[model samples]
Target: MISALNRLVDLVEDHLVEEVDVDGLAKALGTTEYHLRRMFSSLAGMPLSEYVRRRRMTLAAADVVRGGDDLLGIAVRHGYGSAEAFGRAFRAVHGAGPGDVRRDGGPLLAQPRLRFRLTVEGSTPMRTRLVDRPAFRLVGHAARVPLVHRGVNPHIQRHIAGLPPEEHVRLKALGDAEPAGLLQVCDDVDPDAREGSELTYLHGVAVSGDTPTPGDLDAIEAPEGTWAVFRTDGPYPDALQSTWAATATEWFPSNPWRLRPGPSVVAVLDRADDFGTATCELWLPVEPA
Candidate 1:
């Protein structure tokens, strides 16, 4: 996985001003583009697209300072059709317009080339199980919420809080599948898992495929797939969030499974009344790497 990511970085550098064939490269590397993008974002702390933009602007700054090319030429050379488009991208990355930076020879934000390395740390073991599940439907209230990498997402909190207490009981009554209780379902997540990106958040319950969904509820169709379920318990969300991160950093890197495109579900098995601590089962869709 580390080697594949390094190759990806090389590919980006080799095609800074051109289109990057991530799908092609991922196929050649025997991994799906989805998994590649997810892993890259998880470890790099930025989306691959964001990295490309920063790198492009980093190099463009040199040209802007050198004054060897006109703004239009520089823009064209960096894959933008016009100066305006390039300026927007440039300002987004470097926090200064190309024209201003060129005149003052000033502030430039550079995205350093990335390299992946492995560390030998296996002091703690991950508790996981592999399950082959059949198709099911998640039904309940759904909302589009921004992705938050850590802590409780207030948007989700508000969504749940706004629901009538009876709604929770009603949703739990609809459960008839492995994730048994009311589940926290996150779907249509960005493969890159960019923070603040909008994703479909379903506060729902899972039911067998044949189970009839309530007309009043939103439903998400989940196809049959292999799942890697991890069990976590500790302080509120800190432990759960850490386990999620470790799946990318520790588990996937060592295991033969890779994440596939599907909704990630969190089942709270046990919890304190105040929600200060809890045990959770994190269900992630996966396939053999």
Candidate 2:
């Protein structure tokens, strides 16, 4: 996996001004583009697309300072049709317009090339299990919310808080399946898993496919698949978030599995009344690579 990611970085460097066939690359490397993109974002601390844009603009800055090629020529070479489009990308990455930089030969922000490595520390051992389950249904209240990586998502907090206290009891009574409790589900996420991207957040519980549907709830149909369930316990979301990040960083790198497309569900087995701390189960869908 580390080698594949290194090859991906090499591919980006080799084609900064051209289109990268990420799907083909993933296929060749025995992984899915979805997993590849998510892992890249996790380990590199930025989306792969963002990395490409920065690298392209980084090289373009040199040309802008050199002042030989026309702006249109430079733009076209970088795959932008017009100077305006290229300028927008340049300014986004470097925080200065191409014209300004070209004129003054100043204010350049360079994105250094990234290298990813594994660090093994003997710390808290993760409690995890791999489960194979049949298709199921997740039903209850659902809302669209922006993704927040590091902290508790207030949007989700408010959404769950808005539900009547009895609704939680009602949902629990309706559940009769694996993942046997109320579930926090995030679905229809951007493949890149970019922070602030909108995703379908379902505050629901798992039910068997044959369970009768209620009239007043949203339903997400999950296809049968394998799942990697990681159990966590620590201070609020900080511990959960760290384990989530580590899955991409250490677990996936050391395992023979890759994430498949499905909603990521969190089942809060136990929690403090004030919501400051909890022991939770984070379930991610996966398949043998």
Best candidate, lDDT: 1
How many angstroms is residue 22 displaced in model 1 relative to the true structure, after the best TM-score fit? 0.9
Displacement of the residue 225 alpha carbon in candidate 2, Å: 1.7
| Model 1 lDDT tens row, 1-289 | 9999999999999999998999999999999999999999999999999999899999999999999789999999889998999999999988999999989988888888899999987689999999999999999999999999999999999999999999999998889988989899999999989999999999999999999998999998888999999999999799999999999899999999899989999999999999999999999999999
If candidate 2 were superposed on the true structure by all CA atoms, what would the RMSD be? 1.2
Q: Give per-candidate clash totals.
A: 0, 0
Candidate models: Cα lDDT each = 0.94, 0.91
Worst 10 residues of 1 by lDDT: 104-113
Task: Write candidate 2's Cα lDDT for 101-146 as tens digits.
Answer: 9998869999888887767853767788999999999999999999
Candidate 2 residue 151 Cα shift, in angstroms, is 0.8
